[model samples]
Target: MRVIKVVFLFLLIIGVLVLSFLRPDDYLWLSFILALFSIVFLLIRFERRKMEARELVLLAILASIAAVGRIPFASIPSVQPTTFVIMMSGYVFGAESGFIIGSVAALASNMILGQGPWTLWQMVAWGLVGYSAGLMQKTKLMNTTWGRIIFGIIWGFLFGWIMNIWGLFAFTQGGNAVNMKSLLTYFAGSALFDSMHALSNVFFLIVFGNNWLKILTRFKRKYGLLE
Candidate 1:
């Protein structure tokens, strides 16, 4: 099952990239559908595995916390605690839980902020962020404070880049084929916002990341959840 999931994810990534370059217009809906399908499939697989109820409840609470974390930062453009929360969850839990939290947090928050096509992209991008963090949870790089800070900084830009794809498709040339010029222009335009996001992530990770991870780890240990 794990192998199948990996293969499917790889294929999905390839498909999205191909569609983005070849048919940027169509890529919007297609990528959205693919992401939705992937989430559903993962949920189904998780259910089939009979995940523990305690774990499910823990994930729900963590996801809710992550979603709510975005609300307090509404005044600050391009800055939010959602990424830090999700990353910390991924750091403590496994990849599947991290992905679930990231995806769910985006959807939950959008319910209040209003939803559009961009919501799907946000879901996938944030989901990948958590998923990647979880995959590296035990690695030497993730084991160190500076390494985790570096990871957060990189993901900040990566999230922005992924979100920019949607902007390019939606606002540029009325959804035309993606080209070098449009891609460059879109990124250049959003560079400042992305930089702010990256810096904010680094700040949060440096200040609170270890403490958050410790708290979550304690909770997990106390409850015997996600073991």
Candidate 2:
């Protein structure tokens, strides 16, 4: 059921993009409206309604870090600190917070580079990464540093696949089939970079996640959040 929802949501976004291409003057507004509503609805449904001021501030900081990490955008596949930070934040915070942070990071970063549909796709991709990271909370695996390292590898592959899909959309504009060569190149380049990013995330998690969790727990206790 969850998978179905994800598929439908993805297709809906693709449909909106197609509509934008066919009639940018008329459908662009429609696309924007749909995207806005979708994001709002998702945030409300999947996340806590009354997030604390401190959490919001942390989210903003994570987004800013992500944005800044994307400097020198033309470098193809490189080590992206934003991905690690956002994923870790989401794992520690919550899925909703993670999604917001990742999306904001992508959107803000692209503003510095330039704006386009690519930005939107990247935002969606990173947001999903954070969202999925949150699901790890359900499993007891997320409680341990080794578990996070394993999850980070999985996260890296997942991010690489999503980014490759986004690259196909951006490069081919959905006109041609994503050929093997392109797929291979994307995986070889992006997977390598993402794996490194994931390893870095593992290191960060080992070094900082427990301490951050302790701090957030204290804050939560003070505010009576999640008991």
Candidate 3:
């Protein structure tokens, strides 16, 4: 059941991407609605019992800060590490909260900047980052500092790869336009930004990952989240 659900979710996201190409102009609004709907539905379904209203508010505010941070300092060509850091909301909060924060941040930031198909990509891409991070947080290996550093680096690079691929597919003019030359150019252009982003992830993880985890664990204990 879990595997089926994951596959279905992937297919749903891909279907949206496919639809975006077919109706490029309408993709933003559609993406916004879908992302919001998913966030709200997930929130109601998962966190209603675990978190209070205040924590939920905190999650949104954190995501908003993250979204704003990305807009002014978007990764030069593609891939934004700041975006991945925001996705760490899942690690701090929970999967549902992380997803909501990521999705809402993307939607809200895009609205401020004027929505486009890229907004849709941003929403899905960042949301995936948070979701993946949240999932990693669940794994036993994520308990130690080295584990987090490794995970952060791996996921940061993953975000870079995913964003670059999304750019190729989402912005490419027809399938033929994404040739080796263009792909290499795009990859090279994006590499520097991704490097910085990945470095930032590593730095941030080293500096504050344990502290944030402690805070979350403390909060969970106080709030009886485990119960």
Per-candidate local distance difference test: 0.79, 0.65, 0.68
lDDT of 2 by residue, 1-227 (tens): 55665666567667765664455445335534554645563455435466456655666776797789778534645455567677776776667566667777777787677766556556667777777776676677877777877877677677667666666655675637578887787678776677776776676667766776677657657766422
Instruction: Compute the lDDT of residue 211 as modeled in candidate 1.
Output: 87
lDDT of 2: 0.65
Candidates ranked, most accurate by lDDT first = 1, 3, 2
lDDT leader: 1
lDDT of 1 at 54: 81
lDDT score of residue 110 within candidate 1: 79
lDDT of 3 by residue, 1-227 (tens): 44554565577678887887778779766786767666654555454376457766677677778778667665454434355456466776665566667777778877776777777776776777776767677687666777777766766666677677768877776555888998889888877767776777777777767776677668767875522
Relative to the unseen true structure, what is the C-alpha lDDT of residue 194 in candidate 2, on a scale of 0 to 100? 74
Q: After superposition on all CA atoms, how large is the RMSD of candidate 2?
A: 4.4
TM-score of each: 0.84, 0.72, 0.81
lDDT of 1: 0.79
lDDT of 1 by residue, 1-227 (tens): 77787677667766665555556556446545655665565575566466677877888898899889888887887799899889889888877678878877887887788666666677778888888888899999999999988888888889999989778877766567679988998899888888888888888888898789889999889987776
Which segments of model 2 are wrong by more than 4 Å?
Answer: 1-35, 46-58, 69-77, 225-227
Ranking by TM-score: 1, 3, 2
Clashes of each: 0, 0, 0
